[model samples]
Target: MKNLILSTAALALTAGIAMADTVRMGTEGAYPPYNFINDAGEIDGFEREVGDELCKRANLECEWVKNDWDSIIPNLVSGNYDTIIAGMSITDERDEVIDFTQNYFPPAASAYVGASADVDVTTGVVAAQTATIQAGHVAESGATLVEFATPEETIAAVRNGEADAVFADKDFLVPIVEESAGELVFVGDDVPLGGGIGLGIRESDGELRGKFDEAITSMKADGSLNELIIKWFGEGVPTYNADGSVVTN
Candidate 1:
């Protein structure tokens, strides 16, 4: 029930306007720890909390808009939403289309999860959420890449034998692997991908992006950003220092 199918019309009209005073915060509500709909049916999770804090610091009235992952960027460009605070990574290809604020979360590794530790992830069919850097890596790593629209589907592909493994953010896979008990396990060495996670904004919205960047910088300076990172990703999660240097354990 994480993926809420919302009508574009409802999101574009009934939601807050894309004006100077109000900004629509777009997210893939299906991704947990990053974003997910709570039992109260509200967008609640790490990114939601972080986005709320960012808006408050920037002095903008923001409303949440849930969008499917596959069309997130396109919808942003079409004015369906003002900014994407989803757990999207900062990548050069993505930067070509939409501008990104300074990273709020430091770079993390992409890991493979499979039914067995010995699975040949490099040669076997590996699944990844479509449009992610992990999917691009799998396609080029001599693996048969199976793309899914959602992260849940990628894990399902491995569970149902459609794929030998699933590749995703290690932080995202940790809870799943733990919840699975013995069914799922990390299979191979973690692969570092993407620069870091950032908020996606329209290339024309330089002012808006600067506001968020400033807010993020403020959080880092006060150590609140690192606290939030540890709260969600656990202690020892990598973070950027106030001076914008990576802090890794």
Candidate 2:
């Protein structure tokens, strides 16, 4: 009986070690600067860099898994991956479904990009990526909300006149507007939506969430998190100073 109990405990220990050895990092590899696939077809971007550092700090072997934004959370809940390192915003609605680590990115503005600056964003058709806070806002803003499967499609809707404007994170829209060469311009006021972005994990996986939270706290304390935020989102973006106070524009 004693031998059997000792062997059982050993097996559990081994299993726990195996689980800690490889943590799957799930992300939507389409949101550029936050996360996206490179020409080599490997996940690359700000979240990837931050995730890698976090994994290193936590001493966990990590792998990246790309999933569609529309079903990212459902997949996580269904055990598709260990944790979601995507640029997902933390919100009360989402918190009820899954646990979140402390936010790595600060809350930022959402803006509208349209073909014409005079477009009435409140009444005209506006496009947003499905399952996002921007989409929810558009749906409730007295505008005709057009939901798309991907961010690219939202921008295409505006260009093709399927929608008058596309609402999305201002950082994501900046590059698109610049590349349009005056064809697309920012319209209407910037709307602040959602809390800061965080890593989502299964509610049952409290240990994993705590590990990441510790890693993130270390990054914040050392100012590496702020550096990465500025490196990816550019200067003047809000970030925590060394003293843990938020430095904003």
Best by TM-score: 1
Which lDDT values do the candidates have, in the order given? 0.85, 0.83
Highest lDDT: which candidate? 1
| Cα error, candidate 1, residue 66 (Å) | 0.2
Cα lDDT tens digits, model 1, 1-249, are: 111122232122222234478889999998889999999999988999899999999999889999989888778878888999988888777777777998999888889999999999889999998877788788899999998998999999999999999999898999999999899999979888887889988887888998999999999998998888888889878987788788996
Q: Candidate 2, which segments miss by more than 4 Å at Cα?
A: 1-19
The total of clashing pairs for model 2 equals 0
Superposed on all Cα atoms, the candidates' RMSDs to the truth, in angstroms, are 4.9, 9.4
**How does model 2 score by TM-score?**
0.91
Which ranges in model 1 have alpha carbons more than 4 Å from their true place?
A: 1-19
